[model samples]
Target: METNTTSFFCLLLLISATVTAFLDIDELRNIKYGIDILNKPVLLSTQGIDKQLSETIDVTSKHGQIYRCIIPSQMEAEKQKEEEEKIAMEAGVPELLKPMESGPCLFKTRDWWSYEFCYGKHVRQFHMEDGRIVGNVIMLGYYESEFDWKNETNMEIKSRNKNRLNRYHSQQYINGSKCDLTGKARRTEVRFLCEEGTGDYIARLDEPETCTYVMTIHTTKICHHPYLKLPSQQKPVSITCNPAVTDQVYQDYLKE
Candidate 1:
């Protein structure tokens, strides 16, 4: 069952097995378009009504770098700025309270990535505090072998039935199928984890194939929002991931 009813969305999502979305202003503030919205043919019939789902996102940019500004809340665009001023003054001009890698901005949207199926759904926290982002967790799911398939040698002539089923028997009735599933019945594992990136840029930003989540989770070079640098002489800027989570997770493949 679908929950969102609006015809418009401000979240980012991709089509197909993939997800895609857009950031209206900064990486923090994005307009996401999900498959469900497009897939839902029912909502398109709305006549002249406007629907919206808004969220607040914290944006970050390099100290001396140039980036676009974002409107915090879609419903009320200026509230964020007003709140920031109040926040800055209350802190007594302290950088800690006003520590910013980039100007604090709000994100407004007619749509949001409410579809839990998409990668943007895991945008746990998006904030720029003190030139860095803290506690941003991006999650992804992938398949792995439960058994150590890589370690297996070859076919095993087990004591079980030895007839290969796919082949036709005398009448092609297919004798009680039997054969060594030498390379079959692998023990596989699926894993999910949160990645905390403190680098400058995310690798494979487009098709982050390694992880299921597409939205970038950045941390400050020190500890805030994700940091990214421009290309150097040879290589482009890159972001490194700090395992917010690392465990045995599950064995990709094992020999049962």
Candidate 2:
């Protein structure tokens, strides 16, 4: 009987040690277990998940109570910074815009056509039918610095009213899919406006002439900035796309 009792106690100890090894003592301290009026167990934590930091506690559960504590100096500093950014965003203060090397493409769909703008990279126009791309994906334009914006269409004349500081508000996207009508590569000029409070959005797109397009974007990224700087000088923006999935819809469209 004594031998059986000792084996059972040893098993419990082994199980306890294994569980404790997997759990952070600090986290266990922060978590509070209790029963509600309905007899259901509940957990309460003094600190948020994101703000949690772990520190070793020499004492085990046998000790009266365990608690989680952190060196407040570093955590306090981070909290202050997060609060300041939240305040600035709420106040509509223009924060420094992020480098436009990579981000999710902004999409806008209109009657019978959909547009995708991969910022600082490329633009695409595609038609969809019955929830599938119906025709060839039209590359409106890709990023190119040396493309003569002046010879093609005078940007200076377009933004004549804006000051010199705002001259860079317009960008040229050149060398797109060949246009059957014009027998030239389609191109687009993306113009930025500061009307919207925040966010990058393609508000409007129009094809004024065959194979030539104009796109307008509304964003607060450049709201208060006197000078607009293009990040294209840093390096060529890398563009990536998933393989186009061809199903029965695509096959039918090809036949038509």
Candidate 3:
């Protein structure tokens, strides 16, 4: 009885060795094997499977192997954003700011008291005070005409003088307050104040009279120029009101 059992055990060990020799170790490692209810080898994961088998299994394939479908996070976000912008534009939503076209353009303030003209990439601003231009006008490319000045009717100039004084107490009063272009007759000059009540006026003609032109304009369209810049705030200077100091010293110091 003992001899028969020993022979049976040796036969079982030989069969096990033969089966191990015949199997490919690398091929077995490449497969994802699992056990089914009947204890049969079943495929679990399809990654690295042959493309033909992957397709049959309804799996994505890449380079003869199965692969997971994926998209870059940033690429997905960019695509979604592009579609949204396209839809918004097609819906007729106007942009808050429109890019300016190249070349000369006019810009004005909301109150229509300020105007800016842009040309050759250069920008200049004109400000009005008390119905007259109080700042530099020559910097704005002002020129005097050689022709005689022709006065326009009050009715014709009324619309142009809106928000400006029309009637003054006397000619002397008007002269005192109105913009004076006398010095501007020959050439353009800066740091000059216009006639007091001439804020609504413009130099329409090169030389309306001997060297002056009665001009008026009103529009807020000039404010949209590309070269327009915000005005800078003026800094206040401290002054020492000394009794011993002469008036000339104060005046000179102020100029400095």
TM-scores for the candidates = 0.17, 0.43, 0.16
Best by lDDT: 2
Q: Which residue runs does candidate 3 get wrong by more than 4 Å?
A: 1-101, 104-106, 110-112, 119-121, 127-256
Off by over 4 Å in 1: 1-38, 43-73, 76-78, 95-256
lDDT of each: 0.24, 0.53, 0.29
Question: CA lDDT of 84 in candidate 3?
Answer: 54
Task: For model 3, state the Cα shift of residue 75 in Å.
Answer: 6.3
The 10-residue segment with the lowest total lDDT in model 1: 166-175
- Deviation of model 2 at 89, angstroms: 20
- State model 2's lDDT: 0.53
lDDT of 3 by residue, 1-256 (tens): 1123344234335444322122334423332222111211122232233432221111111232221211112334446655754553343211211222242354455354454433222223456778677776433333222111124465643443342323111000011112355654222221111232332222222224543222223222222221111122222211111122234644665676
Candidate 1, residues 98-210: lDDT per residue as tens digits? Answer: 23225332221212212111111112223444645445322222122122212334353211113322111000011111223432221111111112343333222222332
Arranged by lDDT, best first: 2, 3, 1
